[model samples]
Target: MNQPKKMALIAANLAFFIIVGFFVYQRFGIYLNNPWTRDGQVRAQVIQVTPRVSGTVIEIAVVDNQHVKAGDLLFTIDASTYEVSVQQAIANLERERVSSKGAKIEYERLKDIAAKDAGAVSDKDMIRREVNYQQSLSRITVAEQNLIAAKLQLEYTHVYASVDGYVSNINFQIGSQAIANQPILALVDEHSFWVFGYFQESQLNKIGMGNAAVVTLMGYPDTPIEGRVESMGWGIAPADGTVGYNLLPSIKPVFQWIRLAQRMPVRIELEAIPDNINLRFGMSASVLILSEEDSP
Candidate 1:
């Protein structure tokens, strides 16, 4: 063929391939930008067991990594002190009741004597009886409050689990002193688990709230957990420190550095989380967000 004819044939083939490529891209081409897989830590609900009242530990029931149900026995403080307080409260309450009853009887006697026109119980005596009755009523109220407080202290002696979860690392032992606000141990909820994925800021446009993503874990990589975007966090890292809280880079490049993308953690709630496997906190996971668009 002539030189011009061969050149024309080659050009024609290139044009045809370009057209086909464009058509294919329109149908299935997706633009993905700045692909990275940072390590993801598994998050779980942690229960911090703390003492409500100051006491001496008498019974340490559960051990480290022990599973417990709601209202299960966790420990017991010495109830001897609380039991003595309860007895005192009960005695005071009984005394108040008897005094109140006696006041009522005295008031009734005064009423009868005054009605019979006897000076043995004068008007002053009736007035005194009325005052005593009111005083006795107030005493009874105070005794009732004391009784309630004593009963509450007794209940605090027996510690029970507030949540159903697997236990870990019991800090207290029998004969040890435990005070209020002390963290006895921590329990990670095996039933509740989710993943938090940090995606680049560039991917934000394509990924909307409710987009489906496939989650694979280092623990169970074969089992892909399907999840959807539950909600986008409002507090994104600031851009330029003016739009939000953006961290200023510590080191600046002298070679006219290009702008780098920032990553935001997107909380993903699994569409269905099965209770088959224990998903503890700080486990590694990888998620690939299924997107129709390549680069946002």
Candidate 2:
């Protein structure tokens, strides 16, 4: 090759190396400035949908993974028993009212007789009648309370969603028996999405409350979600010295030469999400805490 061509090739190679070196340096600087973690997960509030009244499910208003709003019907329990209870309560209340009315009439008649003639009605008889009337009135009040309770139980037969969320984990059918206070399904709150980043304890000093963050979901790599550090976990479950066989404390042996850093959870509250982005529970995510100067 000619000497001029050789000189030109050397110059080009040097320039290319210089450019690559500068780019690498810039990336390293960014890495040091921002604490990043791929051990992150998308989280949300999971509500256990429990039935307040126990009965056989008669109708299912929603299916698995269906989006539901607040006050939407989730399922209907067979309300035949509840209806009977309400009817029985009404009958008892009516019976009490009639008894109370009869008692009041008797008490007033006795009083009127005693007033017209001083000794016609005995004092003992008058006092007994008044007591009977008061007892009847108390019975009526008790009956009324029973009626109210029966109606409330009937209303509970129709289970409704408590919040705006998605219904999940539906394992029951129309004929399934639902026990009171037992969680039959799960509801993931749509508006309560957040991310938990398991960052190394050593990197905790760089992360603070209200620090700006960028989250990249594994499902949506190109679109980055904005967030801020909401809080940090105060402690994590211990891995050693737990109760084991024979009621003795179990301790795991550790290597002294290689010590692994403990990871602490940092909660990141996501900002307003875009229309196209869909956040789901338990999704894998990567989080980056930007430096104060780099944050907008």
Candidate 3:
């Protein structure tokens, strides 16, 4: 309405526009200088918890999603059978030891007689006694090995956590039959957390090993995680010519005029995480890899 007020209003509008323009320019520059992708996921080492010895699960020391430390007991299989096996092995070993001692004594006695009087003990008899002693010694070794194996199997019945991690996907319960070498649950290694960013081929040139990276998880947008580029995938499975029905090559139809750039996984190793933040497997993330010159 007034001249002075009009000038003040115009000045205020110009200042606001300039500030907005500067902010936009700065963000655009950051994007142009860095490679970013929304196709990112949180990853970690998932260890399959498998039992070396099969038996009924008599006790479960941990529940699903429980945090565990290395050497912590996970579950207990019915160790009664293994205990019996160990006892049997010990008895067999004792028997072998006794037989070996007797054989050795017999062989030594024959050897002493033969040395004193060659005609009293035949050469064939001495040879037979020596062979029997040697065979008995061999049997003792075999029994020792069997005992060791039995003890190992018995130890295996008490499953322990192999690493510091979180137990996951525990589908079995007490009294559940566990088969040898079959995974009963999964353990997500807490210290092995990393990010896998699927970046377009065109952006590969901007990414390099040890490059600084920023990851914004979908679940925790306010807290950004710092990381570095560890490695890049060398290849991806081709979707074009895979074996399909009728034993023929199945080729995907693509537009002749448009070609989609293939995405390759770039692994990012996360830095020290904040105590407040929790990293989980398969969480969606947004990744930004900074240029070498811009990295701190």
- Model 3 lDDT tens row, 6-70: 99999999999999999999878888889999999999999999999999999999989999999
Using TM-score as the measure, the top candidate is 3
TM-score for predicted model 1 compared with the true structure: 0.74
Residues 39-81 of candidate 1 have per-residue lDDT tens digits of 4556778888888878999898888888889898989998898
Cα lDDT tens digits for candidate 2, 195-272 = 999999999999989999999999999999999999999999998889999999999888999899999999999997
Which of the predicted structures, 1 or 2, would earn the higher lDDT when compared with the native? Answer: 2
Per-model C-alpha lDDT, please?
0.77, 0.95, 0.95
Task: Please tell me which model should have the higher TM-score, number 1 or number 2.
Answer: 2
Residue pairs in clash, model 1 = 31-294, 31-295, 42-283, 238-244, 238-245
Candidate with better TM-score, 1 vs 3: 3
lDDT of 3: 0.95
TM values, all candidates = 0.74, 0.87, 0.92
| lDDT score for residue 157 of model 2 | 94
